[model samples]
Target: MPLYDYQCSRCGEFRAFRPMRDSQLPQACPECDVLCERTLSAPFLSGASDGCLSRPQGAAPGGSWRKMCGFGCSGAGCH
Candidate 1:
């Protein structure tokens, strides 16, 4: 199972744990029980410095690092 971020029109944003088989299925908001749609999320790094993600891998200025996942996968999806 994987945790997915969802946003409901009536409610707001929430996360749910669902199996891959149920990914396409509509999710109900925990607060309002309304159908919620999945939303794109960025990867999170615990204990990372504030500017690490925005900075280049090297110490050079105006440098850019390779993007881990252009598709924007997070958590277990990253591996």
Candidate 2:
């Protein structure tokens, strides 16, 4: 199962874990009980990587590199 984001017109946004086969199907809003459509949102990729590290050219200073790069870090390459 994968977590998918959904948006309800009356209740705003929420997440649900479901099968990929049912990704296109509408999900019930947990708050309003409305059948909301799936929304296209960025996937959460914390600690996910392809064994490559590419630093941003002009990234702002003073933030978690793991958050900025979406990869786990050991306090290296982060200022």
Candidate 3:
């Protein structure tokens, strides 16, 4: 399985794990149950390369938390 990124019109962006055979199918928004469109995103590269670390979803530029919930929330804390 591979992780794919999708963007919902009402709820924003989210990630889905699906089989390669079904990769072209739209994903249902976990929040609003709407069908989300897939986003063209950069491929994730693991390990330190050129002395730089890979940033995760909620990581801020200054090494502080960006307060993202990784679930298309407004960062005020998702329910």
Candidate 4:
């Protein structure tokens, strides 16, 4: 089952866990009992599945060691 994200118009932030089969159904707001529309959340990528961003490989600045140029957490905020 895929967990989906939903925002309550009455409340604030909330998430609804629904299977892909029932993804199209309307849901009742847990706060005001009104029908709240489901919003699409950003896709979560992890590890190697993150495509090109998986590694922060880039060129090194002039005067820097070549070893420091390869894949590393130089300034891409890997940490």
> Which has the greatest TM-score?
3
lDDT of 4 at 76: 42
- Backbone clashes in candidate 1 total 0
Backbone clashes in model 1, listed as residue pairs: none
Q: Which parts of model 4 are misplaced by more than 4 Å?
A: 44-79
Query: For residues 1-79, what per-residue lDDT tens digits would candidate 2 score against the true structure?
Result: 5767676776555567789999999998765678989888787565443432323345443332344544343334433
The candidate scoring highest on lDDT is 2
lDDT of 3 by residue, 1-79 (tens): 5667777776566666779898889999766788977788776443322311112444443221123442233343233
TM-score of each: 0.51, 0.56, 0.58, 0.46
lDDT of each: 0.51, 0.59, 0.55, 0.45
Off by over 4 Å in 3: 46-79
Order of the predicted models by TM-score, top scorer first: 3, 2, 1, 4
Clashing pairs in 3: none
Give the least accurate 10-residue stretch of model 2, judged by summed lDDT.
48-57
Give me the overall lDDT of model 4: 0.45
lDDT for 2 in candidate 4 is 54
State in Å the error of residue 6, model 2: 0.6
Candidate 2: residue 7 lDDT (0-100): 69
